[model samples]
Target: MLGSQTQTPPKEASSSITDKTKIKARYFMIWRWHFYAGLYVIPFILMLSITGLVMLFDDEIEMITYQDELVVMPEAMTLPVSIQLDKVQTMYPHGTVTQFIPSKAIDRANKFDVRLADGRSVLVTINQYTGDILGEIDRSDSWYQLANDIHGTLLLGQWGDYLIEIAASLSILLIGTGLYLWWPRDHASIAGFLKLRFSNTRLFMRDLHANFAALFSIVLLLFLLSGLAWTSVWGGKLVQAWNTFPVYYTWGDKPESHLTHADLNHGSEKELPWNLEQSVLPESNQHIHGAYTSSETDKGYVATQNNINIDSIVKQARGLGFTQYKLFLPQSEKGVYTLAANSMGGDITDPRLDKTTHIDQYTGDVLVDVTWDDYTVLAKLMAAGISLHQGDVSVFNKALNAVFCLVFVLISLSGMLMWWIRRPSGKTRIGIPPHFESEGLWKAGIAGLFVVAVCFPLASVALVLFGLADWLMFKPRR
Candidate 1:
């Protein structure tokens, strides 16, 4: 295809990708930033991937290990829920039942959470058909729970929370820059664009790093955003507070709760949606009125006389088409019964199925019923993204999540291997990409980052730390 007459060359060659030495300007800038982020993000991403893989199969693992508690012989007719409560009371006589998980399947057992007099909590399993006590377990000690705690707080509380936030912030840089590096070069062949093409280990590592990231970019980005939505600062203070479902009632009065969802959360993992976390727990007010109805209380409650039966509640939920739901018992006299289902808890992973309702303890009136349709725009995104990130949507989703986890680990390790292979021999220096001495662009990029810092203070703080580290250790000699 060579022409007899000389012609003006394309601004950049198509094969520039094969030679990193030929990369310049914005591409090189992106590569350098991506390199810097990988140094910090790899360890955390690795930890998350490993823990996430286990968490994806939390139900399966717990089922095998807790078959006695979770599985029971199917029966023609299960015993009434009250009879099962009596059995649970026998195991922990002094325990106050705070929550009840009714069996979702025919051969499964119901779980009751008891808060003991000594301030300890245990989950007592009850066989619905025979009303036999299966076994009790400390709520926080399970293998999957341990993985969840590590995934959330790294078992270090606030300090670990901050470290995770920084990792997530840097991953934004990593993913964004990785997309830039993975962009199809001018005149790139379809094979070169999509398939791995490498004669050397160096090319193999780079290709794996870029192509895999490119393939899973959308999933990785969603995981980062949804996971970050649980972080203390960015998620809790800034976004979650504003987007919470606004509690509305026909009655003119605003309400307050004796407790929030945080009080009932399972260890470090969030048990409720971002919207419900901020809402006040509703109380049964004597002045409020609804259609004539009865109410109920546990056996030990002060107003136990003519207590509303739990079967009635379950029947009502079933009537509403709730395939699965969690029930939280009222602690005190004024407390309301809370029944909730959302993507956050893996019951009907679609956000449109998100539903939470509080029934007045005394009146049996619906105090609040917040549905998925009530969530804010961003809250809706978080709900769907969280379900996808957690691999709870469907069978296909879980398989996809596992695959993504494998690709995620491959991307991180391959990039690390590439750096190892490219580093100069006998040099203590990490091979940071060379700084571009371009006109205006470098300064412009810094100004843009300053704007980003202004918007995301945590990311800005991370940038400063990375900049200081570079000045001390990675900066080239004069």
Candidate 2:
């Protein structure tokens, strides 16, 4: 038997071996994709986690860091909002009052956003009790604001936003592939799924990495989706447009306007709710000879009405149950007074209390008022997600987010440590996962990739480049 030519294996055995080989190849292919995604995402995760942690505690940090301005002793009596605005104006007479933020607590100062005649903006803080000019802070130069800017766009504006959006999109693939790799197979017990191994250093890091990733996968995905909703392409052009409120219906007769809520936004701070950022700010009807006259415009005709001052608008806002809100003054003759109190501005801890109202500058009529109940299902989810993402909902939420960010950091480092240990010794080239030619695996992957491409344009571009690299540089040696 030893000397005889080896008998041909059974057809079933041959097919079984081929099937197993295909499965192994598919697993390795997924691992390769995971490794590549992690490599690209590691730097971004580190940056975001650090910056996110800072932003999560922005209020606390500001209270401590800018104590002279942000913190004050409680007094029995406080100055009127109008009087405080007047005092601030007296100090910065050349500055135009853009926004008035009333103090939420007795110990806090009322803040006035002033745009100077020289085209510079500053946050003028006034002692609510004594009407003393506590300090003036250049909002742009705020440390927390810089952290926020870096978190949102790396301070590179649109280009940075695109880079971050792409990273976030690819991170989805990374999470998916990580979960697959973490899935247990042929396990003797639940230890692989639940217990982290510590006998070996490599095994410990591997298990830790896998476990943290698994634990925060859903949270990370929600955070990415919520963050992406504020992006230019997918969130702005696609999801946001689809979920926006029908202001025409809400306003009854839509007023003509050339500007949108986006104009109110400054740097990394979103002054309006995510759903209404692109909404057209309704303009007031112009006054004409004290007669109700019809006017012709692109939208339609509107009757002329009596105009009112900011004092009246402020009174109306207070009467309408706006306690701690931001009142944005009209930017132009026709611009409406925009009053907002929402999680976006960190004014309220509860997303359900989000309220935005557009008051007609000329008529003093409420043009459109949107509350949390008015948001679409998707929009509501986005609002809540953003609140949680920012840790503005509650103290518990803040602690949870802090833990999540720390866990993300640990996961990232553990992954790198595992890779360093497992990588080939003293090799100039990165030890790429072994390539196994499998048409079926590639076909499935391409199909899924097509879906991702459709959803994320920038990520699709990155994927294309990665695909080209895989086909050209990482092709199996002959």
Candidate 3:
């Protein structure tokens, strides 16, 4: 017995009472932090949610509401691109023509983009054949523009933008903490996981909140991430880091290469016999300035001759089987005339816009031609994503985005309800307790300092006041 007297298997040790108390205290602290923070963020969340939903179907709404104005003709005799530009210049003589959009739809004519000397860009739609001004679409009237303003700044400008950024950062933290709280202690029991009983009002509301949140958590996260990517400086850097491939411009010659007449093919067009010595570059010069002159006395820029009449161009482009066409006039001496076309409605896969031709401003010869099929894989993917996001691709995507917007609105409402229910009732609840009444004064002070350090520098001053209050009350109970 003595030999075996090995201390009766020392009673298995159990978790200490102190350990249990500490754990309880820690959980309470986290709960209190969440309650306070959630209460503060509810209003902002609601605003963001409502605005986001409205923006989701903006493209569809615009199309439906402004059908007559947005639509265009596929083929119509039009003035040359240069002449159209000249008309725009005269209309806004003090401004310069920036770009042109050719028509692909039968209802629309042509559009010219002009930049005033003051630096404001204006859109001017013109009749392709007669060069008659049709209408002007100002950015101020754009619903998408308004949505972006509200989504990014709550219409408050830079200060609002900063505040939203802070709110978004807090939202991420809130979501993480919320998920942690939702996790069950016992993995085997699914009792609370899928429960949605509506017998009790409070419980039913809780279930509704939790279930819907869980269902769309991933999508919400994606929206938040993409939005943050566009708002934050660091987020922009991250995007740039991921997009490392250089974007190439095939229409222009690189510094290391010299493109000559021999390097280019005229296709079906015959080269006119002209003085090569006068038109070609010097042996010592690497740059080429190709311009066609109809007469010695009539001096005009090379681009003037190459500019296609918008009305005639549209008719010819339609003959090529294009249902829609968009023309972009050059911005500078070296720029080329760009034409793009697409079908009536949007189709991501074959939405039909193509940068099919780039004509020389001087010779009126096609300088470059590329179809939709010729786009790089990344470019195509980007176009598709944009179309989907804008609700321009398919009805299905539009419906899905519409639902997403509604979900955002619901989320905001739920957040507001939760906050309204938990607002503190008294002044005492508004401030941290003094040291004499609460041992947590020091801890609270530390927390205040930490929050200020991370959130706003101005908060640091408030934190100092909190520390002073704690010192005055506690002073180490001697």
Show model 2 residue runs off by greater than 4 Å. Answer: 1-6, 187-191, 247-250, 288-307, 426-428, 476-478
lDDT agreement of model 3 with the native = 0.50
TM-score, per-candidate, Cα-based: 0.87, 0.91, 0.62
Which lDDT tens digits does candidate 3 get at residues 1-478? 7787656433333346445555445544455444444554556677676665667666567677556656655454556655766676668766656455665455665677665666555677777677777666654456756776787777887667666766665555456556655556554224456577566554555555655666776766655554554443323333422322223333344222132321121211111111110111112111354443332211212233444444445555556565544454444455554444432113112543643554544444555555556545543444444455445556786688778767756765665554444445654343322212334544853774586456444224433553465457534442
TM match of model 1 to true structure: 0.87
Give the Cα lDDT of each candidate: 0.76, 0.81, 0.50
The prediction achieving the highest TM-score against the true structure is 2
Model 3 scores worst on lDDT over the 10 consecutive residues at: 268-277
lDDT of 1 at 293: 39
Q: Taking the tens digit of each residue's C-alpha lDDT, what string does model 2 give over 186-259?
A: 45324557668878888888888888899889989988899889888888887998888563344556775767
Candidate 1: which pairs clash? 296-308
- What local lDDT does model 1 show for residue 23? 50
Cα misplacement distance, residue 321 of candidate 3 (Å): 12
Q: lDDT for model 2, please.
A: 0.81
